[model samples]
Target: MARNISLNFRVVEGRDLPAKDVSGNSDPYCIVKVDHEVVARTATVWRNLNPFWGEEFTLHLPLDFHHLAFYVLDEDTIGHDDIIGKISLSKETIAAASPRGIDSWLNLSHVDPDEEVQGEIHLDVKLWTEAQGPRLRCHIIEARDLAPRDLSGTSDPFARIFWGSQSLDTVTIKKTRFPHWDEVLELHGEEGPLRVEVWDWDMVGKNDFLGMVEFPPDVLLQCPPSGWFRLLPFASAEEDAGGKLGALRLKVRLAEERILPSVYYQPLIDLLVESVLSPAQDDTVTPLAMLDEVSSGESRQDIATQLVKIFLGRGLAVPLLDYLNLREVSRTNEETKADRSGLAVVGRTHLRQDLDLGVLGYKSSSHVTQGFSKLAWCEQSVGAGPGQVRTSIPVCRICAVERVDENAFQQPHMMQVITKNRDGQLDTMYIQCKNVNELNQWLSAIRKASVCNEGMLPSCHPGAFRGNRWTCCLQQDRTVQGCSRTHSAVTLGDWSDPLDPDTEAQMVYQQLLLGRDKLRKKYIEFSEEKIKLEQEVMKGQSCLEEERSGVPEQERPPTATAAAHLLAVLEDLEQAHKTFEQQEKEQVARGSLHS
Candidate 1:
């Protein structure tokens, strides 16, 4: 089974933050992390004890994640950023919240050094009944991809194995993330679970704890445990202060999933494939039609994901998706003509809108822009004035279009369109939207319209130019280089990544193999009969091939032609695999040389 979580959250604001700068204020920014991986970062709010960000993000993560952390840091241009504090929400705590999700101010807490460990260790263990007593043997083979502890980006790692009160240590490997220690330690009649802890050796003070793994004595006795185990920090109580350090206003929501075995999904996969290969009539019953009738919205999404993977494994995803999308489009056309027509109009308008020259009119622009003008259109040159009929700015003169942080516009949702005016000076217009969705749509549409414009901006400020400094980077000059890279105008693509049929099929096959025992129980009665039939078929094929061996090559049966074609396909597959192996070796060699 596989578990998934859909997370939606906003870093609204921070209050009562401790000052990290000498001027009595800090340039604060928020970094959101899901289980050690940084997912998003908010623009820095310069020189503010209390700052409002109002940035939102949506992330899909594995449900097995340990926690979500929001780290507030003071940005500095000259040195590394200072850590203000963090808010850690564990999986259990988030799940216990209301289904509508958490919407409140969360107090920040100090980070503990012991909670920062990461990486994994590989171990092999076995138990034997000796003349004296039952002896346990531990093989500390190696550890790879260990987290760096030193400033030089490497750690001197060593492992200590404990069985009851007795412990053994391995020789430390210096200045490398990948460490190998092919040493075995023997323990006589250990009474408790075996614990293996990997630590980083320090020349001064005590060694730092990297990560640890444990195996029960019962498990070791039953069957020797041998594999790479993910390292985890020692469990400790989280320390959270009640609004002393600071508090952050946040809203978060999660979605979860549980996947079943592949053997159980085979029937559904077969039906879906059959529907695509031999499409049924519109009125006929099909697997997709039945699923639509029965499954909930969330279930449908999960099922669709699985179906896509299954078809991709079979190298039929494109046709299957086209078949399903065509059916859905027809259904929509039959059900609501008005809504379909409206969507068609919107799409056509977007497609016709030229990048170099186009007109965009919105009613809500009157309050957002400088004047009472409600229309923005391209002109031969910038010509807008106080008495102008409409706000005309040349699309070719547009420099940048970027999201406006809440601190800049003092509004919940806004974006800035920077262009050159009639005076040949940079002019900015802020556009407000009712909601985040509308803001994204308008931003995407405007970006699409002005993508091909010449002299486009390479970077843009995400924060306001206020108080004689850029809010994000604290640059004194108004036209100083942007602190953040500007995003490309191209929209995100569909989720069909490059196909790897072998990998996809292997994943499906592995899932089925994991439940092989259950499959055996279900099909045990037919096993002998199936094997007998297979043997008889193989015998008959061999006899027929022998009889056909004397036939002339030109007079050979169609089976011979089919066999030759299959052989050619096998040869091509072998060649492809060899080419891939060679490429992988070259890449590894290059990486080693670079290191």
Candidate 2:
């Protein structure tokens, strides 16, 4: 029995807004929806405060989607798509229900959060960083120690383990975010006694997973998943942070779930065959004595061949091409034409090694004329003319016997084509060929011609997954014309930093508009209040002067430049009030983004 490797994705959003960093308490962690049901939500542990408790919800996803939107009042906020700040997706596949481990799958780059850094200044203070190092490093600088972060993510170098876990035989590095990092766990034995190694953690070939672990017999028996982990190995004092106070307790969580994300799989057996058989070979024969055996969960063809291989004879045989290597060209059960050019099939696919194609195709050399066990064909021939050459006959599969009713869909007996210009004398000549590549290339050119030269709804052809990035085109009747391709702009990964000149400019422009609007409202309210206050002050001055001078009291100075100076002072106060109002509004908006 083979081990099954797997992945499961977990997402955490800052729901309560107290929702702290992913490693700590208060994280709004939620389990992925399985079969359209929200069975469980992840546990939130705080980094600053180490309180662990279950985060309950009266409102769930979709059900409380509106509530979530309300909290997300500012879409322009920072960390909108964070590992914890937002809800992304996960992709994981477990072949066996019994909990067996998997050997390997594709797309395993285990560094998303590792590619970036996360930080905050304060609820009211100022601090900024553009965490950009390699995949697995972090950067931290003591506050008030430098200028704000510049364009680059380089500054104080730092290190962080996104996730960590402890296991039986060996610990592992893991993540639960989907469409996120891809990681692997490998186990190789030592000295045939007790040497076990599980490497390939990052898929960067860093051997992030490569290590020697001495474990019990059962521990190294199988491979592990990405979620497995352990604490950092005890380092000597020299390697420590060397803190005067001591190491701070930074909250952490070892993810227990995994996600499949967007996985592209072909057939496993196909890969195995590719590894074993040489493309240069003609006969389906394998030599064992020349084969070096390694335990990579690899298998071969015949018992005789296996015996030869194990016994040091030239007999390493695996018939990968005979089975999984074969491809069905059309719905008619027509096998692909043998490529004398011998091009290797590219892309991801899967192969069921347990099934035999000889049984499925019902192919037999003895009945080559009547292939497919109970199948027959029809034929027709044509005559020759001045510019034409004739063939004896055309052959087609007419009927098939066994499982013909079982598998109903079949390709047409033959593909049809119509040629507009047979002379091939045009500058732009379109020719149809039996080759899939040629056909695809021809379609590609036509598409380019259509999008570039002529304007069409949605631009390129309706069903193409990708367009001619180099050129676009159009066609009228049979002739075609084209132009260069164009693309839309793409922004940077993070929008939090004000270092972006455009972003800064936009902010300033918006702030100015907001300030102007607010001051307009305040100006009216302040004017009436100021006038009334001045009247009272003037009356007091009048009474005081009248009582003192015996000459008309108004004639006394009433203080120098009385009304004008008073009004000017009042205006200054009003301006100050407006400034405070604008700052408060901006602060409220900014707090929501990071808080």
Candidate 3:
């Protein structure tokens, strides 16, 4: 499937740039290149060695892009621009960072010695694609003198073709001055400017730029135009500053064109989301791999962050993050064979709990533990206690945790932990912490952990335990086996262990998005109710006014006492309706803020 991804690059700032002009300063601007094609340029920052240009760009490309190049150039009005320095990062290097992406200051390298410029550029790269349809076939036949950019006197050459947002790459020929690649690559998207770039591949550092050619789609509409197209030097500061660069001999031509409808691409998007929600076991063909390859310049975190936002808007953030966390856990498991808990225990404290109606006042709590995977406690007698152990809870089994009023106990730090027991009964445990801070900490931890456990599969069923051993692994009786796992029924929540503020915020954000529609519906229903009740109240007031005006009434009550009672009831209802309307308006405001 054609990958849907974008590269978000920010040319944030520059530092310690050498002077390219006579005034001891150079006006620096950034030019970003994918392969040999210039994709973005920043506005010039004049008269400063340290230039701060917070320029950002978003570009869509095929997964075949080799390297991203950033060139810092000094603008010259009278002639060509001056080269300061350049830095290039490969897709593999960026992909290692993935999802969160990269933000760092890279020491600028790859400067022509004769140009006399040096500096570092602060850049941020993120992988993302918001939201393609035709197959354009191209054949790369051969190339020549792709510049000896390597110190080895020969170049490993490759060719890349770009058409609008889509791109294709030919196989690389090793150690050849004139490499031949008789390969055909097919791209999907609307037709636009067809760009071809030749480059010398390097195992390390920046790849050498050979040359590039551009042809309009009109050039391809004809019979596959085949011939040697002379490669041109990249439009760089070196070229502008009266420096000569070599070119390449290249032969490529369009082969065929097949336009596809929009519906044809829907499956790709569906697969992309599906892959994120439930990643494929095979990493090579996974949607995440495809996305990473296309936006190799972007970090995987960028993609995940984008996916999180998208899912949050769609009210699927909880499920989305859960899947991602599981994928992460599975990947970690594969990499390291060490035996460690998947869920990290977060906090432990001494507290008091409500045991039962049989026990009187609060007793000294033994050990109260809170973790991403579960919660557990031990209790003792009022003095140096008896350390009786209570049942440990799997975090997933928890439904709620709330603050409670300290009445009889008079403990300032009081809260309740609610979970389901083995019998599927609501188990509420009232706990009193040492202080308010401790109470808040435990409350937040329990709440965050519960949210993390939202979509996790039970590690093993509650009934998986047959005496001391788990029967689920035997798989002898399908009716009795509740899950695939044979052990660790409550250990499933380790994937999202050690909850932090960011995770907390995400849960809140998801709730707001989830409640958005409900809030709107609620506001409409309340408004309608209030309007109806007000109308009735107004009609009653109209009837009272008519009776007081001494007008003839239809079937009037015989006594003034009944009329007085009716007016009083109408007044009471009007006041009650006004109060209810005020409360509804306040609720709507809160919903708006949350949303």
Predicted structure with the largest TM-score when compared to the true one:
1
- C-alpha RMSD in Å of predicted model 2 compared with the true structure: 37.2
Could you tell me how far off, in angstroms, the CA of residue 413 lies in candidate 3 after the best superposition?
68
Q: Estimate each model's TM-score.
A: 0.47, 0.15, 0.26
Model 1 score (lDDT): 0.61
Report lDDT per candidate: 0.61, 0.23, 0.47
Ranking under lDDT, best-scoring first? 1, 3, 2
lDDT of each residue in 400-503, candidate 2, tens digit only? 00000000111111111111223432221112233322232223222221222222222111011112321111122232221111211111111111112222
Instruction: State the lDDT of candidate 1 residue by residue for 1-595, as single tens digits.
Output: 3333557788999999999999999999998776664556788999999999999876545445778899999999996799988998987878888467889998999877667776567789988887887788999987755666776556788999898888999998776555668889888865789899999999998988888888887788887889877788887787777777799999987655333334434543555566678766651245344333333433344344444545644656456656655555666554544433332232222323311122223332422212212236332221233332335555567778877655453454667788876687787766565554555545654564466667778877766677896544445789876645465422211112112223233333333334333332222222323354346447775322222232343543333322222223333434544565677689899999986
lDDT of 3 by residue, 1-595 (tens): 1122346567778777778889988888877666544445678888988888776555434565556778788899997687776776667766666655667766665465322211111111111122345456667766543445544445677888888887777877775445657677666656676777777787898877777777776666643446666566555543322211111111111111121223432343354456556665654234433333333232333334444333433345345545545544565664432522111100000011111210111122231122234555553312234555464667778766654433213344555555776786655566656554345445544654575444332322221223353221223343442322111111111111223323222322233233333332332232323354346547775433433333223333222222322233334434544565677689899999986
Best by lDDT: 1
Query: Model 3: what TM-score?
Result: 0.26
Question: What's the distance in Å from true for residue 314, model 1?
Answer: 18
Looking at candidate 2, what is the lDDT of residue 115? 17
**Lowest summed-lDDT stretch of 10 residues in model 1?**
492-501
